[model samples]
Target: MKDENIKKVLLLGSGALKIGEAGEFDYSGSQALKALREEGVKTVLINPNIATVQTSEGVADQIYFLPVQPHFVEEVIKKERPDGILLSFGGQTALNCGVELYRQGILEKYNVKVLGTPVQAIMDTEDRELFVQKLDEINVKTIKSEACENMEQTRKAAAELGYPVIIRAAYALGGLGSGFADNEEELVKLAEKAFSFSPQVLVEKSLKGWKEIEYEVVRDRYDNCITVCNMENFDPLGIHTGESIVIAPSQTLTNSEYHKLRALAIKIIRHIGIVGECNVQYAFDPQSEDYRVIEVNARLSRSSALASKATGYPLAFVAAKLGMGYGLFELKNSVTKTTSAFFEPALDYVVCKIPRWDLSKFRGVDKELGSSMKSVGEVMAIGRNFEEAIQKGLRMIGQGMHGFVENKELEIEDIDSALREPTDKRVFVISKAMHKGYTVDQIHDLTKIDKWFLEKLQHIIDIDEAMKKCNINTLDKELLRTAKVYGFTDFQIARAVGLEDELKSMRKASLVVRSRRKNYGILPVVKQIDTLAAEYPAQTNYLYVTYAGVKSDITFENDKRSIIVLGSGAYRIGSSVEFDWCGVQALNTIRKEGYRS
Candidate 1:
């Protein structure tokens, strides 16, 4: 039954901004809608989150304020009679809702075809053990793992695999109920927590301190596939990529290793038959740098936002067009303005993302980062040279001209000792190393970031030391702006200035982030990460990644606009602090863009 007049799409959107499932889906879902509308396709979006830009009426042909439940989506399905349903945009919530719709026979009863992936494909990729089996069939190097339903099963599995296993509760989000436990006691504690999250759990060898890499791949109905962008996390394999400070195009992978992982990404997408978009995560041994496949998310994810923003590829847009049977070649490059859709994005410079944590307010939550990630937001920085980019990124984070200020007064801590154990304050450890007069080369050998970036931060530290030693008060606005970018609070500045009211005014005026039109037309203020609830299972999480810009139509309150670079999201008890650094960056970027601080 090939209906020739298929022009409408039904979108299942992530609902509210709850704990586990927060706002990133809103960005992807919003982008998908914009892409569809650009192609003149009618879009019917059903989401309960009113705060999101996607739920707006103009973004879609028809908007519905509905729960993600299958029955509710089915009702929209019956009324709108869409040509097909797109489950690719929204996060796991939409996928699960589609699963229910198919299971309840609503989609079947209505004869509505699933657009991007069929019901069977979703089931195959989502079921952890099933996905692993499929990957094994393809000879992919997955971790030795098992799905256990109870305490007895967990013990038996641990005994066979040996101790110090990684436990992940099936269907849990953001590493909830996941940890590295050594021996019976720790295993029992982790198992209890995991099983509590879900009846089934996955136990495998813990691969901590390994190299963590993420790939964004897209495919079409014609079986043509292309790798869009690849990212590497600064934190070793054990930490979740989301919670790590990530750099795009990997600063350290040998060309061969990078290609090897890219090939695997293509193969997995083909095997799973994901037509539109997918994310593949890989873990590599730090010593040998050996690569092993982690899990393949069969839908758009947070990384997709970073990938799209970094590459200017518009992944969500191409994916939506692909779902409508448009081949990859038919979709043009949005950023490069190229006609060739087969080409992958190549970076002219480096892009880094520091995960922002909301844990500053919590007590005894263990600031240590680990095999699991616990950050709520992230910030991206770009540089032509590593050091300048590091400084720029630091400034972008509103951390007081971060890498530009010299003589970083650090509370010296041993980095290797810190790395051996994960902490929520890992960035501080990196900062402390720089403050200790460790050369950038030395830092790179230890931390795995480009030496170029380290050198830039070191330059800032050098400058600061000179300023303090010589009492150089080069009191220019530009100098002040640079200082502010590096994370210098007015209190700290006040310490140097002996001006309490000046510092107080600086805090009150508080910086706000605004975007300027880049030469490439990419808005600097791109999006947000809502990970406060990413760790829950089969629950809802919504993250919003929006473009912050201006019409040049200005209004002033007391001749000053109250602006605060909204941090990525709330740093829950388990989330880390890099995202706060991200918020710091955002504040600086706003000031740099000429917005009032």
Candidate 2:
């Protein structure tokens, strides 16, 4: 049955994008608003950000361009009197504001229902002490830590936890006010910052080198649950996920480890009574197969957006429907059309997400990345293999990098020190070290990167070295095909074959390489992303270009004119979700006109 009580809904919008919170919320919020409109529910959205698509005309019934603070939201609640409110679509800002409003009894006074996860459940996840206690009831293994509400308590907890403990602010987002302290002096400085952001702080044993893995899960009101996607960080535990390269469908985990974590994620979400979507993070030691729950985000997060695009699962949209008194079986998967929302998406390709950081715009900012997030935006690339996916992701970041190899050389005084201390230029430093005849095992030992990934990097270096020994004409079709399969673009291949000086211009050399590759019948094929891995017949517009595939999964229709709508590349400063909204609107118009987009 449809929800009769949810005649009108108030949607909280994440305000202006900051360091920790970026355009990911804009994507999630827009999706939630679209879902509400589909259900014929009138929507009132309050966001000061005019540039967002959710604030655009027709996305919501009413738009309030006001601050999302508690007092401001309470006044709007008193005036609008919306029957329900959605807090999970927005980022930490909206979640925090909603919690504050609930604490002040504003939600109860207005008779407004907080949709998705219950307020108490949200509180359990936000407060460090409460989260630990609730998880303990279910026998879940969380980090060894102590929650402190005051400075003295924080000191005592740190002392008990021993030196080199990590301090985290309760209810913080994107790892804000979080850092590792090796001594009491560092502890006091970091704890003061942590206390400023939140009343409660958690001091836990540092798990610096453990592998960080994450799962995006969804649960309906009836307790039907599924894990949509899981991602692994290329950089280990110390660096924030937002500052590391992330890969979906974790590559290094054994089959046993993958299923174990998936089961644990479901158990934790079910025990916590998450009504919609949530993401669970874990720090696992590969050698010992031991792990600890890092934290759980009881709402759509940055990883939620990545997971959605990665596996062609609309997580935010499905979560919104679940919030509206719907079961997973009640809703059909919009992308697959033949499957229910209860079905878990199966991926046939790999996806890599690389963060985009614009730290140069700031003055005297700390360049070293740690627990706190420093990236402003991110890019997701899809390929048939990890090598191709990561290379595409590295180039997609728009950091002037031409994939992993063939980048401008870095001037490092000591390669070992550079690898030991990771900065923004660490990846390039690794490339430089490889050029200096560093072995894969040697680099892996120093940087603590997994041997699998390091070996892949070495393979790319080996290919580049082989290419450098040949000119463009001498680069046979087999070598060119191999390069393309590894996600090397025409430009990168041309430069690798030493064609820059011969052609007088880099663009011309790339054109020559492209023409040669096309003549050799080694072209990219378009493949559709079927959620079931082609187990059953399904149709979807989600697609990616890959050179590894021999045949295209989809065929083109020449009878109808196809309109190609190019979307804004990665989210960054000055341009963000608004551009994405424009592209989506264009596609909608094209589809309405009976033309394929």
Candidate 3:
């Protein structure tokens, strides 16, 4: 029943920028407001983060800078008498609050409808035992797990699952209160913390080295479904997706494997009856076709934002439309504007998202990347290939060092041991190991990172070696171009050539490289991320810079005066979504001031 009688909708925004819940919710919430307003519906947003764009004047019809707890939301509902409330746009904070409101009959008391996926469906996915039973009913393979209420039950479940089990709390966000326990002592300790987060804890068999793959699935009330994007974690199952380096449109999966996972994703979303955007995670073994359904996030998640940006698919916009009782075919792609929302996005370029960890800022904090998320921010970079993408992503992380070529002098006795332990600097450590003559197979055995990625890192090291053999004057245009194509900055090239002052060498090299490039008529061209990869005429401005091709796809119009609003690069601890909110507001102000943005 497509009932579109929604007039005034209340939006719950993620309260404050924290580790697990962060700016992604701000992005989603902002998009949801735009979506509702576009449909001629009035929006009332409740968020304490005054720094958010959604809370800015005019974004919402009525803005209450309040907390997202159930009491406050119920009060808002009673006072505003909204027709509907959207819980999917915000992070776990809003979803949990919505569930509590539904349980307490507050929504019913105020006659407010919960838009998007039903509350029961949300519960079914959030509760481990319910999720397992539901998947089992649909003949889907899931990790063997048991939800326990007490320590005794948790102990028994862990013992049955054998040593090395994963403990997860029911309603935790960003894998909070989750970890792998190798023994009873570890299990007890982890479960104690996990139980504090939620009433129930899940003790499941650990698939430590299995490939962690995620699919951003969307569905409508009419059962129309499509995958917006799929991502693969560079680190295996042991690491949280937020803390690990992730790549979109998984590079390791075979064609058959990709389709198989896609089919499974579609099946899971349909079976779960997810009415908006949902992210499905899977653990797949490379040795065979064996795979296990890890879990499903029945809301707009951090991965959803990454997927949207990576593929140029406005997932939050489409999700908000779907939540407002629109079917997939009823809405057009917001980016391409020509394609329907039902069309699955296709990608010609690779996107690498590296987590930015600021562990050094803290004292005595563990730097290990594990089941719990430790990254405060992340940066996404796009390139034609994995090597280029990874290198670009590393630089975009705002870390001091350039790309993967810089050595982090570690006095480690065993390289394999260091690689085995997951850390924020593991990628750089692996690069240093490869530079020290560690083969791909050796590193693979230690780190469990795919050999394909290792070979790509080796390629970077090979370029560094080639650069080392050439002086600034001797560096040919072809070699310099090759280095640039693989995502080496001018400073990195200067460093590789044994320059004392990298800034001076970079300036000199830049001049020479520019003159040589002019002589060879070699230059970078901007390309649009049209979601169709040029298969269809897409009217979109989303773009990336690449030197692989000659023809520039962007055409500038000089008639209008335009201003560019630079966003805070990535979300960090102290300055997060607040800056993003500021950037969004600045763009809005620029447009309002009669300037093109």
Candidate 4:
């Protein structure tokens, strides 16, 4: 039955900000609360993270600064007696607690409906064995895996799957207690550790060299579905998506492959009866059409927030409406305002998301990129091309990298080893390899990154090489324009031509580059991310800057003065939720001062 009777809703918020799961949930949970309030529903939020803006005054009607475990949620339900409870807005923590509550019949006994994707569907996705069986029934391909209850069973399963398998513990978040085992010894060690976390372990064949791709799928209760966005991991399948450099509107796939994956994503969501947003991950081979469904996150995920920001689609807001019995066609696009939410977002630009790792803060920690997530935060950058987006994203990470080119001196001898091993600095190592005259084919053989992306990196190196040869005093407009087209910054160009040491010389070179670019009319124009690629008249304020074309889409109205507030970039250690709170307060202050923000 449609959930037309939901007048009061309880939202489970991600309790605390940690390494694997953080700020993304705050963004999502806040959006869900706003959507519920717009429908005139009284909202109760249960989140222990007092630092978040979601718990701020007026956001939630009733706020409980409690943990998001089953016991605490059951207490909230008993007291509040909410008409519905939303489990999808929170991270895996809330989903797990909700599932436990359903298993114990607390939700049933209390007459609370678990709105969004059902608890049974969540089980089918979370349980490795059940997930495999359900996908097999739908004829969707999955990697060969075995669920083992003990050490003996794990060894047997590993023997069946062969050497170099992956061990994953059931109910573990962020790929906790998951690792790749090359032989029996490694399998035994990883399995024992995994068993400590959960009762069952999944031993699966490793698709180490395959490309990791993901689709953000949204479905309504009426079976109408649409893919909001699709992303391609810059790093291959061995690394977790959270730790990998990701690009939106996949750069390597052919049209046929894109459509095939999109079809499978829709089919899986429909068969699983997911009534809201779900992220489906895939492992695909670039050489052939072979692919395997990795897994599905039947709730709002980190990828969901990235996809939403990259595409300018309010995923959590639409998902909340879907859970409240709204069909896809019935809702208007909040960004475009002229279109329905049923249409899939089309992009006219590229978005690059780079994971930020603060490994330097901790001592004796491994820096390898594996199935487990270690990134503290990530920054999203948009541009007219891949090179520009990646460079901007690197700068946005606040890691002192002006662009892709390395400023510090490193031994070229280490490039080959760095390429072979996956690390947080792999992209930099690849850049060094390209600068040292390594062929794309050789790097591809060593790193397993796609040749298309390798060529793009080579293009940046080629520009750097050209910059090295240019006379800084006589640098012309054409050269500056070309560099800007490939996403080169003035600081990067100055550093590239050996002017980084002498501050005066570097400043002079930067001024020359900036002046020449401006003289050549090479300034970036602001563009709106209307999700239509300018197919219709879009009335949205979501904007990005690109240097690709001559057209500008921004129209500044001088009639009303506006105060532009910049958000504190990606969340990181030592500087997090507090900045978000400040930004919100700034907007509130602007409104009180009678100015548009």
- The reply for model 1, stretches above 4 Å from the true place, is 1-5, 18-21, 371-373, 398-401, 404-419, 437-597
The top-ranked prediction according to TM-score is 4
Clashing pairs in 4: none
Reference-based lDDT, each prediction = 0.68, 0.88, 0.87, 0.88
lDDT (10s digit) by residue, model 4, range 13-51: 878988767888998999999988998999999999988
TM-score list, all predictions: 0.76, 0.96, 0.96, 0.97
Better of 2 and 4 by TM-score: 4
In angstroms, what RMSD does candidate 1 have relative to the true structure? 9.7
- Tens-digit lDDT track of model 2 for 1-597: 457889999999888778767778888998999999999999999999877778888889999999889999988888888999999888998999999989999999999998889988888888877888999998999999998889899889888888889999988888989999999999999999999998888899999888999999999988889999999998989999889989998999999999999999999999999999999999999998899998889989999999998887889999999999899989988877888888988888889998888777889988788899988788889999988998888888887657888567557798898898778878888888898899988998888888888888888888888899999889998999999999899988888988877887889989999999999999999988777888976677778899999999987889857899887787777778778778878988999999888
Which residue runs does candidate 3 get wrong by more than 4 Å?
A: 408-414, 499-506, 558-560
Q: What does the lDDT read for residue 436 in candidate 2?
A: 86
For model 4, what is the alpha-carbon lDDT of residue 521? 77
Tens-place lDDT per residue, model 1, 320-392, is 7787778887776654453456667666556677666666567778776655556665667654444444444
Error of 1 at 541 (Å): 30
lDDT of 2 at 474: 94
